[model samples]
Target: MLSKDALDTLFTNARTHNAWLDKPVTDAQLQEIYDLMKWGSTSANCSPARIVFVRSDAEKQKLLGCVSQGNFEKTKTAPVTAIIGMDMEFFEKLPQLFPHADARSWFAGNQANIDATAFRNSSLQGAYFMLAARAVGLDCGPMSGFDADKLNAVFFAGTTVKVNFICNLGYGDAQQLFPRSPRLSFDEACKIV
Candidate 1:
């Protein structure tokens, strides 16, 4: 089992940062985050999450155009912004990913099944991405305040991938964090079988 400090790093004390320090997130660190998050579970091992780390000024500028005004400044200032996307064609690789079974045949021509699996599994991967970022000593500011159609055009124009959400990653400014908000109690938010 993980120690208390590790648990705190992953969950209890981790905060969604809105302000970032002036530090760079290296390509190696970004790769490390992916290498960790890639191990997360997905339906049928379909593993549909695709990430684009926007660090260059050119890419960041393109991304800035699609975000809501509320998200603009923080996104612009963060060391890197990860565009989490879902591959609509993810099932094609199921033969390679879930090789033990003919998982590819299950959704090859079925649009509804493909869409449901891609979106759900990719969303789960996005959560795993955030935890992996924290594990790598990076702060995350995840947000959905962006124009998906515009972002898809900018990042994945002719591909079958669709934008899931975006997250800014870097060292955060602690002074900028707000007070931690309340969460639902287990009795209020959960149920026993």
Candidate 2:
């Protein structure tokens, strides 16, 4: 079990940050975060999620044009923004990622399975990415306010990868936080069989 402090750091005290500090996130830290997140499992180990870290002023400007008005300032100001996407052809790597069996053939030519698996697994990986970021003491503001097609055209052109969401990463500015929202109790949101 994690200590209370650790739990708070990863979950209890973690909040969706809309404001950012002027601090910079390092390349080493980004590498470390990906190293940790990549270990999480995916179905048939397809590992579909691909990430693009936008840290440069030019890239941020490009992204600024892609985000919705509500997300403009936070996204533009955050030290880093990650574009998380899924590779529709992820099954092509199954021989390397899940080599114990003929995993690739299961999804090969099966567009429906490929689509569903990529979406589901990449979404899971995105959650893992957030948790991994939290574990590394960074704050995140995940958003889906942008036009996915536009983002894809801009950042991932000529690739089968597609955007699922964007997350701003930085040392957050707590002074700008909104009031914490409530959550449902166990019985209210879940049920026992």
Q: List per-candidate RMSD values in Å.
A: 0.6, 0.7
lDDT of 2 by residue, 78-152 (tens): 999999999999988989999999999999999999999999999999999999999998999999999888999
Please list the residue runs of candidate 1 whose C-alpha ends up more than 4 Å from where it truly belongs after superposition. Answer: none
The residue pairs in collision within model 2 are none
* Clash pairs (backbone) in predicted model 1: none
lDDT (Cα atoms) of all candidates against the true structure? 0.97, 0.95
Report lDDT (Cα) of residue 4, candidate 2. 100
State the TM-score for model 1: 0.99
Query: What is the C-alpha RMSD, rounded to one decimal, of candidate 2?
Result: 0.7
Question: For model 1, how does the per-residue alpha-carbon lDDT over 1-193 read when each residue is reduced to its tens digit?
Answer: 9999999999999999999999999999999999999999999999999999999999999999999999999999999999999999999889889999999999989999999999999999999999999999999999999999999999999999999999999999999999999999999999999
**Could you tell me every candidate's TM-score relative to the true structure?**
0.99, 0.98
Clash counts for the predictions, in order: 0, 0
